[model samples]
Structure formats: C-alpha cells, structure tokens
Target: MTIAAAAPVMLCAWLPTAPGAATATAALAGVAALALALWQMLRRLGVPDPDRAAALILLLPSVALNGVIGAHDTLWAAILLLALVAALDRRHDAMLGWAGLAIGLNPQAGLTAPLFVALLINRRVPLLRWPIAPLAAAAALLGTGSVGWTIGLRPLLHEAITGHLLAIDAPNIWTIVQTLPLGYPLLGLAIAIAIGTIATVIAHFAARPIGDHDMIAAALLCTMLAAGLLPLMHERAFFLADILSLALALVRRDRAHWRIALLVQAGSTLALLGHASGIDALTILGGGMTIAATALLAGPLLRPAANDNPVIARSA
Candidate 1:
C-alpha cells in the first residue's frame, strides 16, 4: 500500500511537466492516505509478525511494478484491496465509508462498493456512515484538484469520473464487441457472454454472503478476460485484474482458485513475453484462452464451496 501510493509521488519530483506533476502529487497524497488507513487497520487487527511478513512478500513486487512502469491507477487499486481486507474481517463501518470515498475519488475503487453491498446483504453497517467518507473524499480530491487547474475542473473531473469505462484498456466483454463491426455475427455472441458473466456474478452475490469475495474476484477476472479475450486488447490492462485474483485466492485459502489465479498470472507473463519476443498469435491466443477459462471457472467452483461450508465463515 505504501509503495503503490508513494512511488508515484517520488517519481513526480523528477518529472518535467506541470500537469504530470499535479497528477502525480495527488496520486501520492491519495496513496499516503491509504497507507495510513492500512496501518490503522493493521493495528486494529493486532498486527502480527506473520501478517507483516506476508504483506511485505505480497506488496513489494506490486510496488516495484507500479513504480517502474508508472502505473498511476494502481494507488487506488491498493486502496480497494485494503478496504476489502478490512471489510472481509468484518471491520467497522468507517472502513466501508473510506472504501466508498476512495471509489468516488477514483472509479476503479468502485469495485469495493458492489463487493461491500454484497457483504451488507448478510452483514450490518450503519446507514449514515455510508455517505460521509465518500462525500468527504470526493470533496477533498475535487477541492484540491481545483486549486491546481481552475476554470474547467468540473468538466475535466466529469470526464475523469467515467474515464475507467471509456479507456480502451478495459478488459471486458466490450473489447470483443469493439472488435466487430456494429452488425457483425460475433457481436451478439459477445453480448451474450457479457450478460452471462454479469448474471453469474450477480447470482453468486445474491445466493450467499459466504461467496462475496469470490464473486468480486470472479467479476474482476471475467471483466479482464472479457477485455483481453477480445481481439483488440493491449497487454497491460491485465496486470491489476491478475493481482486482484491472486489476492482473492489467498484470502479464500482455496487451492483450486489459486491454480486458476496462477494460470492467469502465467498467461499475463507469457503475453508480456510475447510482446517482448514477438511470439505468434496462435500461441498467444491459445495461452490466453487457457488463462481465461481457468479464471472464468474459478468463481463458480469456489463460490459453491463457500456456500456449502458454514464452517468456513466461522473461521474467517
């Protein structure tokens, strides 16, 4: 969390442009805030030596990658994970509020909102607490950004609000639809695939609270696959989705999900290699399908296990 939030700030100090500097600085501040939140959460959880070790092992590579590649959106991604960790453990309503605000600040963090709502179907949180943190976070980001870029900030922020959906890097079913001409035969098939994936996620969330995490994990994975399996996806969009899948696997302590997660990770790694080594499309798509199938299958299998085992909830 600290690394994801901090590295960008560190990088901005050396960059030459003003807009880049402002963006980087805001990201840094957001990351720093997230780090503090994570620390407070760890303390609340009674941070053990093992927890610290595990966090370090997991986060170091993440931080390094974001820093090296200058992946700006990752700071918000870390915030979403921290919120998930807190929420999964049944933490206070304050954490959910923070997660929501983080979502408003960066739409990528919106993933936490649906996950939390799914959690709320079976869990309890005060309603008032729901709006405060998100409102405050939105106010802060907008107020701060306005100080730097005045006249047209509203329009710019509005663009930023929905930017995640518009970005070509979105690895969802639309990617495939985007590949086809408006009336192409594959367009209908792509729509069906998207509806099915979304319906599966919703059904899983609706059926059992035990599978909330798995639902979120599967949704993200499917979104990524739907994004990448499309003929048009670039490689980098798979990165954060893959990370979230791995984390979900760890949280569930399910080997099957882990295997699926690894397959996706391996596919991403191979895709990166393909980009670097100029590998053939046949090989790339073949590997991608394997990864996509494994990830896509993981949710249903793991979700059912959670519903079947009441003992798992007690342990968590």
Candidate 2:
C-alpha cells in the first residue's frame, strides 16, 4: 500500500488544494521525466538516433493507459532512471536517496532495490566513511517498513501474494497457466517468484561496471521477471519492464532490439486497452503476445556477463 501510493501521495502533497491536479501533474511529469532520462542515456551511449529513440516512450499505448488514465506507476520508472543515472555518475548518495524513495514507491521496483544495493555493495563500494553512501543507502530500509508496521506483516504479505488475483489480466507465465483448464494460482505464484529469483541471481553475477549494457540488462531482468509473473499484477505491471526493454534496445542500437521493445509494450497495451474497452480477446491475446515477446527478449538478456569479480562469478 505504501509502496504503491507513495509517489501519488507525494505529488498530492504538493498540490494539496486538489488531488485531481496532482494526478494530472504526476501523469505528465512521470513520462516527461522518463523520456528525458532515456534521451540523455542514449546520448551518452552514442546512439545515432538518440532523439528518435528516446521519443519512443511517448508513443507506447501503455503510457496513455497509465499516465492519461490516472495511474501513478510511471513515477516508479522515473525514480529508478534517476537513481540509475546517479549510479552511473558515481554519486552514491544520490543513488541511495532515489533508491530509498523507489523502495517506497512500487513493489516490483522495491524488490529490485535490495538486489541493486547488494550488487552495489558487491562492487566494493567500501562502506568507508569518505562518503556517507552507506548512511544514504540506509534510506532503502529506513522508511520502507512503516506500511508493514501499520498494516501488520501477515496482512501485508497476503495482500502482496496470496490474497490477490488468481487470474491476472496481464500476460506472462502465470496468465498463460491460470487460463488453462485448471488454474493453479499458488503454483503459478511460486514459479513466478522462482523466475524472478533466477533473474536476480543472474543479475548479481552479471553486475558490470555502471555504464555497460550488462548493468541495465541485469536490472531489466530483475524487474521484468517479477512484473511478468507475480500475482498482484495487472496490465500496468509491465510498466517498468517496458521502459527497461526499450532502454536496453536503445543502448544496443539494434533494429531487432527495438522491435522486441515495441512488441512487449504492444502486449501491455493489448491488456490495458482491452480491459478498459471490455475486449477479452485482446486481453488474452495480449497475454500470449507478452509471453512470446518476453521469451524472445529474456533468452538473450539473461546471459551472465563475463567475470569481472571472482566473488560473484564463482558458483558456490
């Protein structure tokens, strides 16, 4: 509850006179911020068509669904992008500060924060007192527990996993499985967590220097795995994953990669618009589209980067 509403509430605080105004502001600000970040990141990566590529986010159907339809989830993507930029610049304090806020923003993004922090620590960021990165980094932990305390852990856990949707409207493994003759919601949830875990482990080992494709690809895997499979998810679930996929595509500057980004996002759109318009076929087809598109994406992206650190590289 805290994670999901943190961004919206913060925005509302600024526009205290009218929450409607805040929602309007959040929608525009989140996508605008994300687009700018993508543009800058592309310029840094030396993509020839950075301008064209960065504008891609503006055209995604899911953007209209979430941003125009009053969903605040885009803020999660924006904050992570800011935090990633900070990490790339070695501004560890800023990174932690954004990361902490991200942990308080969305569960999929928050779930990836610990893994990101763990990878940062593994990179020998040295908790030495020269910079207060550790102190700054504690932001991820500090304010994140308030919601759990308020709601009680058991209820929170139930809300997160067990007590939620058995038939998610979005695509991925669970949607595919649950739509079968006999749905296994618990089993599907277990498999989703396992997929996310595998992605997390791969990301832990594949931690490249901040600027490399490995870093973004690894991060993409961490978030996409969960957004794709977890039970509390819906059409908007793939929001971060869609952004990351496009980012990875832009970083690589491959036409095929761009197509991959387009397709997965198209799937998200299918589910979103379908549900909104009451088109069940589009939703189901969107699920299949998501499954097919992500399958093509995950296989290539999930490969471990060549060893740069023995501690992470070695199998235990």
Worst 10 residues of 2 by lDDT: 147-156
Per residue, candidate 2 scores C-alpha lDDT tens digits across 117-214 of: 65565566656522443344344335434322121123335555654554456656666666568634475556667666755664544354433455
TM-score of 1: 0.59
Model 1, position 152, has a per-residue lDDT of 20
Error of 1 at 116 (Å): 1.5
- List, residue by residue over 54-109, the lDDT tens digit for candidate 1: 35323534333444444454455555555655665666464565565455435444
lDDT of 1 at 161: 55
Report residue 279 deviation for candidate 1 (angstroms). 8.6
Error of 1 at 232 (Å): 9.9
